[model samples]
Target: MNRPAARLLTFQLPLAAFLVFLLFPFYWMLVTALKPNRDLYNLTVNPLWTWTPTLDHVRRLLWDTHFLPWMRNTLVISVGATALSLAASLLAAYAIGRLRFRGSGVLGITIFLTYLVPPVILFIPLSRIVSALGLWDRPAALVLTYPTFLVPFCVWLLLGYFRTLPRELEDCARVDGASRFQVMRYVTFPLALPGILSCLIFAFTLSWNEYLYALVFLSSTDQKTVPVGLATELVTGDVFQWGPLMAGALLGSVPVAVAYSFFVEHYVAALTGALKE
Candidate 1:
C-alpha cells in the first residue's frame, strides 16, 4: 500500500476504536432502557439489540417514583453550588492572580493543593458540619458541601485565565476613577467569561454526579440527587432493576450533555487559556 494510505488507515483505525469504546456504554444504556423486562433477561435473544422494545421502564420510572422531584432537587443543588463557587472563585482568583501581595505565590499553591485533597477524607468532617448546621437530610447540605471542593479548583482555573489577561487594563480602569470592585465587575469578569462558563460547567457537573455526599447527607428518597436516587432506589438488595436503572441513567445524563454541547466552545477556550480582547 502507498505510505499516505497506510498512514490514513493507521490513524482512522485507532480513532474508530476510541469512538466505539467511548460511545458503547451510552448505546448499551439506550438499548437496555428500551428493552422489556422479559427481553432484558432472556438468554435466547441478543441483548445488544432488542427485538421487543418497550417504554414500560421509562413510564414506571416517571409515574411510580419520585424521579421528577429528584431531578428538581439535583437542579437546585447543582445551580446553587455552581453560583456560589463561581462568585467566590472569581474574587479569589482576582486577588491571587492580580493583587501581587506578599506570599501570593504560596497562597495560590495552597488553594490548588486544597483541590487535590481527596473528597473521601473531607466528607467525614463535612458530614458533621452539615449535621451541626441542621442541614442533615436536606438539599442545602449538598449545596454547601459541594463548594468545599469546587471553589478551590475554580479559583485555580480562573486564576490561570486571569493571569493571561493584562494587569494594565485594570490599572487603566482604576486611573479613570473606577473602584476596585467596579473594575472587577465591569472589566475582569467580562474578559473571563470563558473561564467562568468552564467553571460553571465543572462545578455543576461535579455536584450533579456526586453520590457519596448525597448518599450520606440525604436520607429521604424525595430529596436525593439523580446519582444517589437511581443507585439506592433501583436496587433491592440483590435484585437490580436493570431496565429502569438504565432508563434513569440515560435521562439523567441528557441535561449535562446538552449543557456541554451549548458551551463547548467556551469550555475549550478556557482549557486552552485563550481569550479574544
Candidate 2:
C-alpha cells in the first residue's frame, strides 16, 4: 500500500503541472478579456488577476458591434452541419457496422483518410465551385461545405463506437421483427449514444471554429461565421482591438466549452483504454 501511495505522490506533481500548462492559455484569455482596454497597453504575465478586472470589453463587443450577427451565423451553420453530419454518419456507420458488402473495408479506410485531407488542399477549388454554384460569400455555402469535413470524421467515429457494441443486441432486435434500419435506430444507436454524441459535439465545434474555409468562401460581413467575422471586423489593419477581440473570443468559445464541460468525463471514459462501459 505504501509503495502505491509513494508512486502516486511522485506522479501527482508532474500531472498537476501539465494540467496547469494546458489550461494556462484559456485562463489568460479570460483574464485579458476582463482587463480594461486602458490596462491592456501594459504588460502583465500574471493570469491569476491584475490590479483590477472590468467588463467594458465584453459590454462594448456585445452592444457596440456586429458580433450578434456573427454569433447567429455561427450557430446556424454549426447546428446545420452537426445535424447533417449526424444523420449521414448514422446511415454510413450502420451500413459498415452491421451489413456485409463488397469493398466495405476499403471504403471505410477511404472515408477516414478523407478526414485527414487538409482544408488547405481543397479550399482553392472549393471556392471556385462555390462561386460557380452562386454560394460564394453566401451563408448557404457553409451549410453545404462544412458537411464534407464533418461527415467523414463523424462516420468514422460512429463506426468504431458501433463496432464496439455487442452484435447480439442488434441481432436480437432483428429477430424481434425489426428491420435493419429499425435495429440501428432502436438498439445500436441507443447503446452507442455516448460516443456518437461526443463525435457530434466534435463535428459542431469543428464547423463553428473553422476559419480557413469561412475566410475563403465567405467575404460578406453579414454572412461571416464568428471565426471569420471576429478576425476581419474586430481587428483593422495593424490595429489589434485587444478588448473587444478578447470578448469575442470568450463568447465564441463559451458554447463549445460548456458542451465539453458537460460531456468531457463521458468522452474521456468512452475513448479510454477501457471498453466495458
Q: Number of the top candidate by lDDT?
A: 1
In the range 73-167, model 2's lDDT, one tens digit per residue, is 89988998788888888888788767858878888889888988898999999988999999878877887888889888777777778778889
Q: List the residue pairs that clash in candidate 2.
A: none
Q: Write the per-residue lDDT of candidate 1 for residues 1-277, one digit (tens) a residue.
A: 9988897799878899999999999999999999999888899888889777899999999998888899999999999999998888888888888887999889988988898888899788888899999999988898888988999989888888897789899999999999999999999999888778899897888888898999999998898999999988888798888888899999999988888899888777765663331
| lDDT against true structure, model 1 | 0.88
**Model 1: lowest-lDDT 10 consecutive positions:** 268-277
Assess every candidate by TM-score.
0.93, 0.88
> lDDT, candidate 2, residue 68?
91
Per-model CA lDDT versus the true structure: 0.88, 0.83
Give per-residue lDDT, candidate 1, residue 162.
90
- Candidate 2 to truth, TM: 0.88
Off by over 4 Å in 2: 1-13, 43-48, 270-277
